[model samples]
Target: MGERRDTQLDALRAVAVSLVLYAHFLAPGGTSFLGHLGVRLFFVLSGFLITRLLLEARDAAAFEAGPALRSFYVRRAIRIFPPYFAVLGLVWFTDLEQSRSSLTWHALYLSNFWYALRNDWTPWVLCHLWSLSIEEQFYVAWPVIMLLAPRKRIEAITIGAIAFSLAYRFYWPITAVPALARDLLPPASMDALACGGLLAVRRARGADVPRWMRRGWPAFAAAFLAVVWS
Candidate 1:
């Protein structure tokens, strides 16, 4: 049977997917609030789940960095690679207009950076891959950090990353940098993931969340409405 916690996560995932679908199909115009909220929810959930798994592995009695890292990578590869490559193959075979060079970016999981550099979206077939690239990039760096960082310091590191992401997003446009750099790149959006990681770590440590905070659904609902109506 699946863990009880997974039931809550599955419900959250359903809600996130619904919001994304609603934003895409029903909402008018660019960057709908629901879409952004859904994407953020996905990021947070990804961070939480990945961090929790890594922590569990580290705490295992037979933990060895080499074997553990290899195992993690293998599992991720098995889970993510086949379908991803199949889609890329299909796109390549069918889309004569797509630049051969652009395929390199997608293959390397750097489609987000490629689009950001050009300040244009990839063809519809690949435009949505940017978020996948961001997550893949995160997967590359996060595991190493989690494996090496001291337990007490991990929370601070995650917090610092979140702060940096927020600052980068807020300030990037003001600078002479490219607009898409902040808009599409992982650095400017890492805060959502970091927030999730922070929560996971705290929960793993058995930190007591206040009852008021635990029951703050009204606040979230109000915020959601504010975004939707804004």
Candidate 2:
């Protein structure tokens, strides 16, 4: 079971990271489509793992709530922040003599909004790290979701996902508010992550294998290929 979980999780992440890298390094025709799908898959995967971890915490006797929140952020920081700051340090060393601005805001995760506001902010090397900020913000708040809410309330998580995913679409002007554009990762981008959380909840209860999903994987695959061919 754990092996299957790891495989699917890796598959989902590998799909996103591969597409994002391709979109950056190569001029692939399907990059945009694949990138969108891949990013969504990442978010879904995140939700699934986060939900699983929270359930484990909920179930285990020694699992305190503090670790639930702390370890989540710690693991996230270890995975992301080190290389991220290294890039910033590297960039700062190389090009301050030629470039127009300082590295302050980018370090602060405010670069996205800064550039969006100034209209002068061109792309930089560590540009993709902006998504990391969004993910971190999600981590910071997601644990509380598990903390306050009852385990049986599955729709609560799903509704939260729906609300978040739909928020920017409904409130674009507010979303378009650009001061912290980098900080504000679009809710839609997180839809897949939330889907993963839902799946996690399913997994804990043996509901992980949705009837429709189990029944339809083959059909879905065929239809997906048909759509691709057409």
Candidate 3:
């Protein structure tokens, strides 16, 4: 366990979780600027590390997606699905706030798709869980894509995904801004994850991105700060 530990990552996780708690609980209007920053940090870090791991798995001359596919789905299922349902059920059934006609749909991570289909921002019952929904959606699709996607294709997808996300934000400034403003969801939120994945691949090829990011921490902090503060 100790061997697996990355001190900087551990520190960041601690900070991120703490900020999430503080942002949700203490931040005014059920949100906080600092708290929001915490989550962004997490997304970036998750991208960075998860991609790195994927690249490592790709190497070892072991690009076979079998192990990655099985391990990831299983771990994600155990860690996310059960607890998510448990919590969603608890909140809805107990009427923690209010009852609703439908919830299982959201529990299934179809909220965004539904939101795209219909539009129910109310019943903010498990609003926070939406991020997890996006993540689950990512797990369901990304790994399969990652497993099959050629190295160049994966990189292009990552770049394109990020670009489209940003374009949505820029074009639909009103819509994208709010999502980005929200702690959980940003307009091109998944791009950061993809970016991390890209970074991971670069690392696999012995092309260093981590060192650049670390040394350019000032730039990263500035760019992130602009987005958060804006």
Candidate 4:
């Protein structure tokens, strides 16, 4: 059976995209934070949807990891790669010099690393690919962790991931790591993904959010403040 549509999540996606569009196109200066929030929302949404699908698949398959893993990779590749390569092809045919020069990294799904290593966002045309690269990296590893881990351990694993991401984000800044790399590295950004995954796992287990979090606005406000603090 096909998954049910989620209108709330659809609204969130629309809002996130609008935030990014407005940040990049409509807003003047000092609005990069909006763009960051939009991208973080996208990361969370992707994590939630993908983990939910995997959990559903696992249950349907009676926890058969092989089939679930195969189905995920195949579907992910089909849905992600074609349009990605098509975009690259357009860039190539149009002779976009900067994007074309970096096309190899994007094609290999290493654009994030390439940008982080350089500590720059040159080839501005392809700068956005860094987030896509992080998503692809997460896609590669998350299914294995989600599908293969013991059912009871899923929450713990997700929590550990969130902790690890937070630790990395916190620890990197105090060290010599370049700012771009600190922010763009996969580990540093996994908290949002893991937070989303945690929500999916809890939902799949038929668990409701804690009572303290049940009121939506308060939780949202707290999260917004936490993001600002971090």
Candidate 5:
């Protein structure tokens, strides 16, 4: 089951990356809807995979908060920081004029917030790091919640997060909130991640796939069409 799921996820990742590359190279002005969809797909996929890993760790014997958190942080740092700093260093050395003042924000994983407030000042190459910052921020909060919350309440929490994210995005105009608050922040984007986490929880609990979704190619066709239309 795990192998099959991993294969499916790899396929999805390939599709998402392909869409992003296509948008960058083929689409006019690099503003294609496909590019946005690709990023959303990545966000959902990341949430699902990370939650599944944490769930597995929780199920293992001798799980403890301190050790689990330390391991998680160490693993994340090793996996993420090396390549990230390398790229940042290259950008800093080659494009000092554009990256000098804003390098601190990237280093501190607050590039998203910085860009939100000063959209016009963002260097194009580092603009993409905004999503990475959001993911890092989510990682900080999710493990603690998962460790402390009752298993029965996990789904409820995920659903509540999704609802809160939707409300934050939708209510911004009505409340006259600044665009910066709603656009690049983690809260406004939690819905997609929470949706993925919810699915992971349901699957882990052995919930059956819905009849409509289990109908095979027809269901797949409908989903594909919906995505294309969107």
Candidate 6:
């Protein structure tokens, strides 16, 4: 039910990947902020694409939630787990100290929690996995949210998620919590995903791009830069 691919999205993915490469390889000191921007872009793209697939699956299954949910989970595991485990297997075979030290957390997709609680990126080779952990968290949680919410209320639910994420990010800096926790935790980082989901919902309903969004991207860009650079 989700076989179609968008060339536009492919182009966007290429751009996102290039940005991450630039950040990691070219940016002086490997500016982590730029890498973060790339990861956030990937998150938004994933939310849009995955939500669209789930919507299509639901419709194709005649809203039979069980079959759609099971199919999605199966496809996701087959697609995601093999390559992931292959990497871990290589790490284990080579006896990489950092990976060996934290293999359990990485295998369980809980590396984000490990890094945040430790408040240090000791295993730099595995540092990138925190984002993957966030993505896995999104995959596990988003389908249930999409299927259980009333169709008409889905948009509202997504917006509420975005609001909660933004609020958490704003409030977190004042707390005694580690900065890594605020940035790595799912709750504080959901705004980009929710915004992507909102866009998918609107497009599925055949709604035109809102006038505000069409005109406000510059403003949005400015605001995002301010927050990231602050």
Clashes per prediction? 0, 10, 0, 0, 0, 0
Clashes of 1: 0
Q: Looking at model 4, which ten-residue stretch has the lowest summed lDDT?
A: 221-230
lDDT, candidate 6, 44-146, per-residue tens: 8999988888877766737688877898889889889999989889988886755698989999999899999999886777887898999899999999988
What's model 6's overall lDDT? 0.84
5 or 6, greater by TM-score: 6
RMSD to truth, every model: 3.3, 5.4, 4.0, 2.3, 3.9, 1.5
- For 1-230, candidate 5 gives per-residue lDDT tens digits of 01126889999999989988888788988366787678778888988887877777777788887777777778888889999999999988998557877889999898888877774435867887888899999989998887778989999999899889877777765764345556578886787788789888888889977676677868665654444333
* lDDT of candidates 1 onward, in order: 0.81, 0.63, 0.65, 0.84, 0.78, 0.84
Which TM-score value belongs to model 1? 0.87
Q: Write the per-residue lDDT of candidate 3 for residues 106-193, one digit (tens) a residue.
A: 7678555544334445556665665666666766776777667787787777777777765654555465434433323334467566
How big is the positional error of residue 22 in model 2, measured in Å on the Cα after superposition?
A: 2.3
Query: What lDDT tens digits, residue by residue, belong to model 4 across residues 1-230?
Result: 13567999999999999988888888988657778888889988988998898888878846588877887888888879999999889988886755777888989999888889888888777888888999999999999998888889999999899889878777777883567887788996798898899999999989888877676768766765465345
Candidate 4: give the clashing pairs: none
Q: What's the C-alpha lDDT at position 147 in model 3?
A: 68
How would you order the candidates by TM-score, starting with the best?
6, 4, 1, 5, 3, 2
Q: Tell me the lDDT of candidate 4.
A: 0.84
* Candidate 2's TM-score: 0.73
- lDDT for model 2, on a 0 to 1 scale? 0.63
